[model samples]
Target: MTYVAVALLLGLVILVHELGHFLAAKAVGLPVVRFSLGLGPVLWSRTWGGTRCCLSAVPFGGYVLLALAGEKDYLAAPLWRRIAFSLAGPVANLLFALCCYAAVYAVSPGEHSLAGYCVKPLAWTLGTAQAMLAAIPRLFGHAQELSSLVGIVAEGGRFVGASASRLLMLGGYISVSLAVFNLLPLPPLDGGKIVCDILVRCRAGLARYYVPVSACGWLALIALMLYATIQDVCRYLA
Candidate 1:
């Protein structure tokens, strides 16, 4: 039951992040091709408001595809719209974290005031974001401390088993982590996408290389995930 709950919670976070991008694209008048909750082969799909919503076989990650097919197509959109589409996913995760933190405060046994409910959660969310930013540099120094989704789910299961409050806290932490991770200035990440878009817009000559750069980014990201998973498995075994 604990593992099941953790899985569901993780899925919800991914869903929320993708939903943010989908909504932002729609708001900016960009045609969305698909909104998928997972990756790889589609298990089930249905068209809604001209967008194909899909559930894929893999449960670890998700994406929102715009109607654009190539670099020219993507660049045709307004720069601000592209930036908004990129930013929305991380912003959604942050807001979800805030809600989770608020829930944690609400459920705790205490003489909570209106200000307490409002201020404490905001403070905690900001604090968590700050801590994550601070820890980013340390992660490079302490690569072994890095964790994959496997480790995250395992740790989350433990928290869920401890108590409801701890579960909420865990959820909030994971949401913030998701937001921060996506904001890293590496290729294929939201931050990376934004940076590339801005650079290309400023220097149209760079447009030709976008696809190759993005492909390389995806390769690097996959390699990192595999390495992290191996570390998680070895840790569990030890």
Candidate 2:
């Protein structure tokens, strides 16, 4: 039961991430090609409101595919709108994290729960995020220390086994991590897209190199993921 709860919790996080993109695209009048719950083979699919939503075979991550209205139509939209679309995912994650923290801090079955809510959770999340950023130097300085999907599930399972409150707290921390990770200034990421868009606007020459840069970034990320996964498996075995 705890394991199932953890799996559902992780899926919810991915759903929330994609929801941000979907909502932002709709708000900006951008057409969506598809919204998938996972990556790989489509297990189940349906079309709604002109968008094809699918459940894919892989259960790790998900994405929202936006349709180009036209070569000129999409380009005609203001740059700010495009940036907002890219930023919505991370912003949503941050907001969800704040909500999770607030929920965890409030005592349930009591009258003062909502009234006693404060910004402490938000501040704590910020501090935790900063500490994570600071620890990046150590990843290169020492052995691989980051958790992969398996490790994440394992940690979530442990938390769920401990208590629901702990699971909520873990969910909040994971939300913060997701927001921070997506904001990294590497191609294909939200931060990367925003940075590249700005660069292209400032200097048209950079536009031609966007694909190549994004491809390289994708390869780098995949390699990092592979390394992390291997480390995670080894740690689990040990």
Best by lDDT: 1
Prediction 1 TM-score vs. true: 0.97
What is each predicted model's overall lDDT from 0 to 1? 0.91, 0.82
TM-score of 2: 0.91
Question: Residue 188 CA error for candidate 1 (Å)?
Answer: 0.5
Model 1 spans with C-alpha error above 4 angstroms? none
- Candidate 1 lDDT tens digits, 1-238: 8877888889999999999999999999999999999999999999999999999999978999888877799988999999999999999999999899999999998889999988999999999989999999998889899889999988889768958788788888889999998999888999999999999999999989888999999999899899999999999999
What 10-residue stretch in candidate 1 is worst by lDDT? 158-167
Candidate 2 per-residue lDDT, tens place, 131-152, comes to 7788767877675677788888
Q: After superposition, how far is residue 147 of candidate 1 from its true place, in Å?
A: 0.4
